[model samples]
Target chain A: MEAPDSNIAIAAAGWHFLCERAEILVLRVSREGAILHANRHAVELTGIPLEGEPLEHIFLGFADGPVGRRLLDRTGETHLANIRTANGLPETLYFTALPAGDEMVLFGQTDAQEQVRLRKEVLALNHEMGNLSRELTQKNAELAWLNAQKTQFLGMATHDLRKPAGLILSYAEMLEEEASGTLREDHLHLLDTIRASAERMKRVIEDFLDVAMIESGKLNLDMGVAAIEELVKSPLLLVSKSASRRGVVVTTDLAPAGQRLRVDGQKLEQVITNLLSNAVEQSPDGATVQVGSRRHGDGIRFFVTDAGKGFSEEVRGRLFTAFAGTGGQKRDGERSIGLGLAISRRIVEAHGGTMMAESPPGKGATVGFILPAQCLAPMRSDEQNGGVR
Target chain B: MSEQPGSDPRVDSVYDRYLASLLEGERTECTSVVEGLRAGEVPLRSLYVDLFQRALYQVGDLWEQNRVSVATEHLATAITERMVALVEPGVFGGEARRRVIVVACVADEYHQLGGRMAADLFELHGWRAYFLGANTPHSSLLDLIEKTKPDLVGLSLSIYFNLPSLLAALDAVRAAHPDLPIIVGGQAFRWGGEESLRRYEGVTLVKTVDDLERIATGHGSP
Candidate 1:
C-alpha cells in the first residue's frame, strides 16, 4: 500500500510552474533509498504525461539501454555512468539513492534555455574579438602606408633641393668670375639673374631642411652674439640688385638699436632678410621700403615697411601660410610654392621670440619681429652715428 | 590619466596655437575651448556664457591692442558659434522651437552671436525661435514680423555701427505691433543691460539671461 502523500508532491507542482514560466525545470529523486518517486519533469523531458504511472517506466526512460538496471540494483549512493536522455541529447546526468524500504534518486536534465543563452554570449564575444583583430590590422596597415608616404616625401624634397642647389653654386661661380673683370653689362644682368635664382633656390633648400629637422626632433638652436648691423646689412646687400631693378628703395636705420645679447645671429639675419625681400617684391615699382630697429625693453623690434600694393583682406587672411606669396598672386591670381616666409617664421620662433605683421589694405604692409637684446654685440655710437665722439 | 579624444600630441600643440594668435585669424584658445566643449563634463553653455565668452571678450580687447586683426577676432567669434551649435543639442535636445520668430539686426552689424546666444538660451528654455539670419533687408524683416507675429521679438547688436539700423528695426516693430513685447541684448551696450535697458525708449533691452527671464515671462518693461 502507498504511504501517506509526502511533502515532495507540493514541491513538485511548484517546480512544474518554475519550468513553464521562465523556461526552467527541476527534477527531485530520492538520494537515500531505492526508487521512491519521479516528478512531472517527464512531461517536458520524456514528452509524455505519467501522473500516477509506476515510477519504473520513466526511470528506465530517464536512462537509456542497461543504464537503468545498474542504477536500480544498487542500494547506497553511487555515481552511475553519465546517463543519456532518450532523445540522444549529449549531456551527463548523476543520481544519488537510498536502499532500505522505498529508496529515491535526484537527477536533473541540463537546462536547454541556459545552453542557448550561453551559446549566444559565446558567439557575441567571439565576434567582438574578431572585430578588434580587424581594427588592429587596419591600423597597422595605415601606419605602414604613412611611413612609406613620409619616405617618398623626403626623397622627393631632397631631389628637388639638389636641382636648385647645384644651379646656385654654379651661378655663384659665374658671378665671381664676372666680378673681377671682362664682364659685359648684359653679363652683369645675367649674373643678377643667376644670383636671384640662387637666392630663391637657397631659400627653398633651407626651408626643406628646416622642416625636415623640425620633424625629426633635431632642431636645436645655437645662440650667439650677433651684431644688429650684420642682420640688417647682409640681406639688404644680397637683395640690393633686385631692389634697384624693381625701382624699390630699401633704407635702413640700424643705428645700434640695443645691446647685442644672446641669440641665434644667422637665423635672425635670415628672418630680417626674408621680411625685407618679401616687402621689396610686393611693393609696386618706385615704392619706398624702410627697415628700422629699436630697443624694445629687454628685446629689439625690427620693422620692414613697404610702400607698394598693400595686402588685401584676402591676402592678409592667408599671409602667414607657407608658399602663399604676395606678388604675382595679386596680379595673375598665382601663388608661390616657396618656403621663404615660412622658414623665416620658424627660425624666429625657435629663438624664443614672436613675429607679427600689420597690413592695412591700400596702406601697404609692415612686417615686424622682436628678439631679446641680450644676444647682440653692443653698438659703437661714435663713427656709426656721425662720429659724435 | 584621462585622455581627451581629439587632442593628439603628435599633431598641433599649444605653441602652434600661440603663433597663430600673434598673427591673424583664431588664437589657439579658440580650438582649446572647442576641445573643452567636446570633452563635456560640465554644460558647455554655462561654461561659454560664463568663461569662454568672457575670454573671447578679452580677445576683443586684444584686437583693440593694435597687434591683433579683425580676422583674428572674427575667427574666435566663428569658432564660438560652432561651439554653441555643438553644445545646443545636449543642453536643449534636438527639437527646435518652431513657433517663435528670432529677430536680429542687418549684416553690416557683422556681430550677432550675442543675439544668437539669446536665441539659443530661449530655445533651451522652450520657445521655438526663428533666426532672421544676419543683415536681412528691412522690408523682409518687417514682413516676416507681421506674418509670424512671434510671441517675442529678440533683437541683438554687437557693434555700435549697427545702432541706427537696430533703432530702425525697433521702430518698425513698434509701428507694426503695439502689444507685442521686444527684448534687445548684445555687446555694443558697454554697461551690459543697465545703460541700454534705460536707453531703449520704446523697447526692452535685456543685459543677460537674468534680465531676459523677466521679459520672456511677459512682465516686460514699461
Candidate 2:
C-alpha cells in the first residue's frame, strides 16, 4: 500500500494517546437529562448499551440519592456522586463538564465503593436514630426510677436506723472504757462483746451510706484549678505517712512547673490521696507506688500503680465500694465506705472526664483517670454575675 | 451513590456480565476521606479511622489468616489511627447531656475486635463512645463504672466459654448501679450465650443490627 501522509499518521497516533492517557468517561446527552453518549467504562458498568440512549432509561435499574439527580438537571453544573453501573454495582462517580464547543461532553468516573457505601449509609441512619431515641428514653426512665428508690431507702436508714445504732455504739464504747478501770478478769469478756457490737453497728451504717451517696447523686465536688505540678506534690506528701505505715515507697511523676491541670484542688486531691492511701493499705510495706501522667489522646491521663498483692476478680468487683476491700478479706481501718471511689468518680465527672482501675490478680493494680482540657465557651455576662436567679 | 449509567451495549467485560462480582465482601462506603487517611494527614474519623468495623477488620484478617504479616497490620493500624485522629478532635467529652457509655473486654478476655466494633458503631451512629480499650482490669472497669455511670453498659464477649466471667462482671456492676442497663453483644451471643446472659436481669443481648437498634431505642436490647 502506498505510504499514508505523515500528517494523517500523526493525527491517528495523537487520538490513541488521548484515549489511553486520560481517565475521562465521556458521555453525550441532550438538554433534558437524557443519555447521548456513554464511555467504555461507563458502558461496562451500566450493562446498558448502544451509541444512542437516554440517561434515565438505564437509571431506573438502581436507586438514586439527592446528589445523583442534581447532576442530570444542571448541564454545566457538575456533581461528584456514586452511580451504579448496569451491573447494579456502585461506583464513586466523578461527573464533570467536558466542554465540546457547541455540545457539552459529560465526562465521569468513580472514586471508589467506599464513597458510595457512605452515601447509602446516610439513608440507613434513619433507622439507627429511631433506635437510639427509644433507647435514650427507656434508659432515662429506668435511671429515674432507680434514683427515686435510692432516695426513699436512704431516708429510712438515716432517720430510723442510724440514730438508734449510734446509741448502741455509744453505750458499748462507754461500757468498754469504764470496764478498763475495774480491770477485772470476768469483766474483760463483757467489754470485748460491747466493743464488737459497736463495730458491727458501724459496719452496717457504713454500707448503707455507700448505697445512699452513689444512688442519690448527692456527692459534692469542691472544684478548683490546681497546677498539675502542685497537685501531684500535695497528694504525694499526704500519702507519705500512710505509705511508710505500710512499707510502700510512694513516687510522684509530676510534670514540670509549667504543666498545670484544672481540678477542684480539694476534691481531686482527696481522690488522689485516697487512692494513694488505698494503695498503701493494699500493698505490703516496701512495695512501690508509681504515680505519673502523660498526654493520652486529647486529654491528660494520670495513673496510680501499686506493686502489691494485687486483686482477685471477685474482690476487685467490689474494690472501690464501701467495706469492699480486696485480697483476703476486709481489714479494720481499711474498710472502704466504698464512698471514696464513687465520690471521686462524681468529682471527676463533674470536671468532665472518666476514671478507672486496672488490676489482674497477681499482676498488681493500676488506677487511672482522664480529664479533657478545659473548654472556652464564654458564659453570658448575666449568667456569670450570679447563679441564674 | 445514585443509579449508574448502563453499559454502552457496545463494549464487554466479564465483571459486567455477573452480579456476584459486586456483591461479595462489599463493605461500609466511606470515600473522599480515604486518601487523607492513607497519607496519615487525618485521623480515621478524619478518614483513617474512616474504615468501618468490618472493612478495617478485613485488613486485619488478611494478616491474621497469615495471608499478610505484622507489617501490613501495622500499616493498616497507622492508617486507622490517623483517620481516627482526624475525627477524634470533632468528638468531645464536654457534652454530658447524652450519657457517654464505654465497654470493653475484661483482662481475662483476650479478643477485642468485638469491643472495638461496638465502639466504632456507636461513634458512627453519633453517640459519644468511651472505648475502654481491651484488656482493661476489672478494678479499672468498676472504677470506670462508678465514674462514667454511663446510661448503658455495652459488654462484648467473643468466646462463649468466657460467658461466665462476663456475667460475673455484669453482676458486679449490678451491685453498683442496679438500674444501669448492661448490653452484651458480639460472638458470645451466638455460641448459646443468650441463655447464659439471660440468667442475669438488667442484662440485654444483641445478635443483629436490629437488636442494636432496639438498644438505641432505649428498651435496652434483650
Top lDDT prediction, candidate number:
1
RMSD of 2: 22.6
Q: Can you give the DockQ of every candidate in the order shown?
A: 0.01, 0.02
Off by over 4 Å in 2: A1-143, A159-179, A183-215, A224-262, A285-302, A311-328, A331-339, A359-363, A371-389, B1-222
Q: Mark the 10 consecutive residues where model 1 chain B has the least summed lDDT.
A: B1-10
- TM-scores of the candidates in the order shown: 0.36, 0.35
Candidate lDDT scores, in order, read 0.60, 0.59
**What is the C-alpha lDDT profile of model 2 across A1-389, one tens digit per residue?**
53679778986776455444545566666555556656665666666673566554544333554443456556566676655566576655667754455555676755657645754454235323423433354355456667677666875666577777778878777877775777687777776776676666665565466457646666665555556766677878977876777678877775433455656677677678767766776777688888877766666777888877776667656655544443233445534445566556666777898887888778678886788866112224434685321
What is the lDDT for A361 in model 1? 63
Task: State residue B118's C-alpha deviation in candidate 1, in Å.
Answer: 44
Q: At residue A381, what lDDT does model 2 achieve?
A: 47
Q: What C-alpha lDDT, on a 0 to 100 scale, does residue A107 get in candidate 1?
A: 47
